[model samples]
Target: DQQVKQNSPSLSVQEGRISILNCDYTNSMFDYFLWYKKYPAEGPTFLISISSIKDKNEDGRFTVFLNKSAKHLSLHIVPSQPGDSAVYFCAASQTNRDDKIIFGKGTRLHILP
Candidate 1:
């Protein structure tokens, strides 16, 4: 069973538009969720995160919304730019300890210029 899954392997959007990436999880024990962005061969960089207790968190052009009841989460990038083209990974983990994280394969976002 995939504890975390990103059904869409890729997404495309035109510049200045909205881009939304989705993620689903089956593990109820996961209490912390994070979104990371990666470009080329670089490691993923943390974009945003939300604790299970919270439903939403935002940082500049990025926003993450968690629906605990549905076990679903999404990352929204507004006014998507060409520079936003990269792979995005959704990760979840149990909080308060040194626990390993479960990550979706990733979604490749292509922003058309």
Candidate 2:
């Protein structure tokens, strides 16, 4: 079973609009939620992160939220830009358990002109 899942395979948002990507995980032991962005030719890079102890974390135009009870998390990008188009992946890890990180299927975000 996939511990982490991205329900939406793709999402499109107009320029200057908010882009929200959702993720769900089954493991209650997960302590960290991470969002990664992958360009066409580059490996996925860390975008944002939220710890289980906190409900939300924000960086510039990017924000990450974690809902422990719902076993869900989301990444939000404000004023989506064309340059923001990329494949986004949601990941979860139990830092106390081991080094293994579970990744979602990923969602392709299209920033429309």
Candidate 3:
């Protein structure tokens, strides 16, 4: 079975700095990787994603990096801000398989002033 894991339960970063969230997976067969941000009582919103063919994908302040060799991936948030504070989850799915997504436990990011 494929499992996504986020070891850190939380991270604290100062405003105007960078925040790095890490994730690891057990299955190399996963073809798609995604990051999602969620607030209390709200569903997670898509942040970014990377395909198995690509190593990196970026959109504005969010970037998703994949390391197929190590079965690892990371999310980078440049110039982190208070508004960026939320619980981030790492997810994986196989495109060829059913659209079942495996999600990590999630990492809560705190932007401190």
Model 3 Cα shift for residue 44 (angstroms)? 0.7
In the range 1-113, model 3's lDDT, one tens digit per residue, is 43899999999999999999999999878999999999999999998999999999999999888999999999999989899999999999999987688999999999999
lDDT of each: 0.95, 0.95, 0.94
Report the lDDT tens digits of candidate 2 across residue range 22-98.
99999999998999999999999999988899999999999998999999999999989999999999999999985
**C-alpha TM-score for every candidate:** 0.95, 0.97, 0.96
RMSD of 1: 1.0
Candidate 1 steric clashes: 0
Better of 1 and 3 by lDDT: 1
